[model samples]
Target chain A: MSTFIQQLANGVSLGSIYALIALGYTMVFGVLKLINFAHSDVMMVGAYVAFFVATGLNAGPDPSIASALITFLAAMAGAAALGIAIERLVYRPLRSASRLSLLIAAMGMSLLLEYGGQVVFGPQHRRVPDVITDERIVLGDLNLTVHKLIILGVSVVLMLGLHFFVNKTRTGTAMRAVSQNVDAAKLMGVNTDFIIGLTFAIGSALAGAAGLLVAFHQQGDIDPLMGVYPGLKAFVAAVLGGIGSIYGAMLGGLLIGVAETFVAAYLPSSFRDTITFSILILVLLVRPAGLLGKFKPEKV
Target chain B: MRGAAIKLGFLVVLVGAAIGIDFALREIFNPHWLRLIELAGIHVVIAVGLNLINGYCGQFSIGHAGFWAIGAYASGVLLTVAEQKWGTPSAVVEILLLVGGMAIAAILAGAAGLLVGIPSLRLRGDYLAIATLGFGEIIRNVIVNVDAIGGPRGYHGIPVYTNAAWCIIVAALAIWFSRNLVTSSFGRALVAVREDEVAAEAVGINTTRVKVIAFVVSAMMTGAAGALYAHLDGSLDPDTFKFTKSIEFIIMITVGGLGSITGAVFGAIVLTLLPELLREIHPTLSEYRMVIYSALLIVIVLVRPKGLLGNRELSPSAGIAWLRRKFGKGTA
Candidate 1:
C-alpha cells in the first residue's frame, strides 16, 4: 500500500515533465496545425544548454537554488530562440504549402537538430551538474524527495501562469484567435505570424523547462538523443489528451505517466510501454476527439 | 497476342538482365559494393511500398518498419525451423524454402497490417500517422519481450539466401506491381481519395475499403522486403526497426517525389549511396552525412515543395520524351 502511494508520487513527478512537453506539441498543433517534430529536439537543445550553463557556472558539488534558476532561464531563452527560428525559417516558407509538405519539413527540422546536435555535442553523454539539493521528505509511509517536489511545484506554477496568461493577456487572446481561425484573426488585425512565432516561443520555453526538469529527474544523464522517447510519449500524450486542448495535454500526460508507473510496478517492466500505448489506442477508440476535445464535424 | 508476346519478352529480358548483372557484378565488383547495391534494392522496395499508401492513397504511415520487422522475423523463424527439421536440403529444397519463407512473411505481415490498419485507418491524416507510430513502437517492444526469437539479443544465424539476383528481381517485381496498381481503376480511386476524401465518399467510393486495400498491399510489399533484408543481412534485430528507420523510408519517398515509382527507386539509390560517397570523400565526413541529407530535405521542401520528381515518371521512354521535347526535334 505504501509502495502504491510512492509509485503515484513518482508517476506524477514524471508526468509533470511530460505535461510541459505536451503543452508545446498541443499549442503548435493548435495554431499552425503542424506537429513540429523538432519540438523534442528543441527540448534536447534546452537540456544541452542547461547542461552547459550548469557546468560552466561551476554550480559546484553543492546544490544552489540561484544557479538552478539561472540555468533554467538560460536554457528556456535558448530554446525559445530556436523555436522562433524554426518557425521563421522552416515553417514560414511552407505556410501555404500542403500539410504533407509541412510535416516533412518538420521531420527534416527534427533530423537536422538531432544529427546536428550529434555533430555539435559530439555524441557524448554529458553528466548534468547538480543544481538542486538531494533532500528527501518523509510523510509516514510516503517518501518524497526535494527534486520531485521542485518538479511538481515548478510544473504547477508554470501551468497556472500559462492558464492566467492565455485567459487574461492580449497576446494570449490573439493566440487563441489565430488558432481558432487564422484568416479571421488576420482580418481582425492580429499579426498571425507574430502570434504563431510567440506560440512557438512559449511552447518551446515550456519544453526547455521540461528538459531541465527531466535532466534533474534522471540525475543529469543528458544526451543528444535523450529527447526521442520522452518526446514521442509526450506527443502521444498531446494526442491522447486531444491535440488542440491544453488542459487535455496536461491530463493525458499525467494519466500516461501514472499508468506507465503502475504497469512497471505490477507487470513485467517491458510491458510498461506496450501497456501505455494500448491504453492510448483504447482511449482513442472510445473517444475519437479525446477526453477533453470537442469534435467539430468537417465542413463539406 | 502480339502485345502479350512483347510484354512476355520484355519480362524475360528484364529477369535475364538482373541475373546477368548479378553474376557479372560478383566477378567484377567487390562484395562491399555488391552489398551496398543489394541494400539499395531493399530500400527501393520499401520506399515504393510506402509510396503506395502515403503517396497514392494519401494516408500517412511511419510504422512501416513494424511490418518489415514482422516479415523479417517470419522468414527468419521459418528458415530456422526448416533447418532444424531437415538438415542441409538439396538445391530444389533450398529454392522452395526461400519462396515459402517469403510467402509466409507476406501473409503474416499482411495480417498484422490488416490488424493495425482496420482500427487506425478511421483516423485522418496526422492522427493516423501518430496511431501507426504508436503501433510500430508497440510491435518493437513486443518483439523484444518474446524470448523464442532471441528477444533483445537479436535473432542471429539466419542463412543468406538473398543474392543480387533476388534483390534486383524482387525490387523489379515490386515496382512493376505497384506501377500496375497505381495505373489501374483502383489506383485512380486512391488518387481521388487523396485529392479529396469527402468528395470521394460523396462519389460513392468506399474510402475506408480503398484505404485498407492500399495499406495492406503496402504492408505486404514492405514485409517481403523485410524478408529479403533478413536473408541479405543474415540477422534480425528489433533495434533496426525503430521509428527512426521508418523516418528513413519517409525521407526516401519525400526526396524522390511522392506518388512517383521511379522517384522512390531513385531516392532510395541516391540515399543509400550518398553515405558511401561521403565516406569515400573523407572517412570522417560520413559522420555528417545525415546532417547533409536532412539539410537537403529542408532545402528541397522550401525551394521545391513537391520534391524533385513531383509525381512524374523517370523511365527511359519518359526521359527520351523529355529530351525530345527539350531539343524540339521529336513529335512536334
Candidate 2:
C-alpha cells in the first residue's frame, strides 16, 4: 500500500510534467492546425538558457528563489523567442500551402534545431542548477519529494493562469476565435498572425519552464536530445486528450503518466510502453474523437 | 518501322550498359565506392516506393522502415535457417534461393502493410502518420524482444549475396514499376484522391482500395529493398530501421518531387551522394551536412512548396521541347 502511494505520487509528478508539454502541443495544434514538432526542442532550448543564466550570473552552487526566478524567466523568454522565430521564418510563408508542406516544414525545423543545436551547443550535456533544494518528506505511507511538490505547484499555477487568461483576456479570446474558424476570425478583424505568434510564444514559454523543472527533477543535467522522447509522448498525450482541447491535453497527460507509472511498477518495465501504445490504439479505434473530444462534423 | 528500330536500339543499349556496368563495378571501381553506390540504389527503391504512397496516393505513411525491417529480418532468418540445413547451395541454387527469399519477404511485408492500411483508410493525414509510426515502432519492439532472431544482439552470419547487379536490377525494376504506375488510370485515381478525396469518391473511384493498393505495393517494394539491404550487409539490427530512416525517405521524395518517379530517383541519388561529397570537401564540414539538408528542406518547403519536380515528370519529351524552342524555329 505504501509502495502504491509512492508510485501514485511519482505518477502525479510525471503527469504534471507531461501536461505542461502537452498544453504547448495542444495550443499550437489548436490554432495553426499544425503540430509543432519542434515544440519540445524549445524545452531543451529553455533548459539551456536557464543553465547559462544561472551559471553566468554566478549563482554559485546554491540557488535561491531569486536566482531560480531569474533562470525561469530567462529560459521562458529564450524559448518564446525561438518559437516565434520558427513560426515567422519557417512556417509563416507556408501558411497558405498544403498541410503536408507545413508538416514537412515543421519536421525540418525539428531536425534543424536538433542538429543545429548540437553544432551550436556542442554535443555535450550541461550542468543545470536545481531551482529548489532537494528534500524527502514521508507523510504516512506516501513519500513526497520537494522537487515534485514544486513541480506540481508550479504546473497548477501555470494551468490556472492559462485558464484565466484564455477565458478572460481579449488576445486569448482572439486566439480561440482564430482556432475555431481562421477565415471567419480574419474577416472579423482578428490579428490572426499575431495571435498565432502569441500562441507559439506562450506555449513555448510554458515548455521552457517545464524544461527547467524537468532538469531540476533530473539533478541538474540537460542535453540537446533530452526533449525528443518526452516531447513525442506529450504529443501522444495531446492527441489522446484531443488535439484542440486544452483540458483534454492535461487530462490525457495525467492519464498516460499514471498509467505508465502503474505499468512500470506492477509489470515488466519493457511492457510499459507497448501496453500504453496498444491501449491508445485500442481506445482510439473506439472513440476517434478522444475521451473528452466531441465529434465536430465538417461541412463537407 | 523506324520507331520499332529505335526501340530495339534502345533495348540493346540498355542491355549493353547493364553488362558493361556490372563488369566495371566488379573490376574497376573500388569496393568502398561500389558499396556506396549499392546503398544508394537500395535507397532509390525505398524512396520511390514511399513516393507511391506519400506522393501519389496522398497518404502520409511513414512506416516504410517497418515494412523494410520485416522483409530484411524475414529473409535474413530464412537464409540463416536454410544455410544450416543445407550448407551453402551452388551459385545457381543460391540465386534461386535469393529470389525465393525476396518473394517471401515481399509477401510478409505486404501482409503487414495491409494490416496497417486498414487503419489508414479511416485515419486521415497525421493520424495515419502516427498509426503507421506506431506500427513501425511495434515491429521494432517485437524484434528486439524476440530472441529467436538474435534479439538486440544483432542478427548476423547471413551470406552476402546482394551485389551491385542485384541492387541495380531491383532499383531499375522499382523505377519501371512506378513510372508505368503513374501513367495508368489507377495512377490517375491516386492523384485524384490526393487532390480531393471527396471529388475522387464522387467520381466513383474507390479511395480506400486505391490507398490499400498503393500501401501494399509500396510495402512490397520496401521489403525487397530491405532484403537486398540485409544481404548487402550480411547482418541485421533492429536499430537500423528506426523512425529516423523513415524520415530520410520522406526527405528523399519531398526533395525529388512528390508524385514524380524521376524526381524520386534524382532525390535518392543526390541525397545519397551529397553526404559523401561533403565528407570529401572537409571532414568538419560533414558535421554540418544534416543541418544543411534540413535547412534546404525548410527553404524548399517555404519557397517552392511544390518541390523539385512537383507533379511534373522528367521525360525525354521535356528535353526535346526545350531543344525545339532553342533551335527548331519556334524560339523567340
Best-matching candidate per DockQ: 1
Model 1's C-alpha root-mean-square deviation from the true structure amounts to 1.6
Winner by TM-score: 1
Question: For model 1 chain A, where is the 10-residue window of minimal lDDT?
Answer: A279-288
TM-score of chain B of each: 0.95, 0.93
Residues B237-324, model 1: lDDT tens digits: 8899998899989989988998999989999999999999999999988989889988999999898887799899888888887888
RMSD of each: 1.6, 2.6
Interface DockQ of each model: 0.74, 0.59
- Screening candidate 1 with a backbone cut-off below 3 angstroms (N, C-alpha, C), the clashing residue pairs are none
Model 1 segments more than 4 A misplaced: B1-11, B329-332
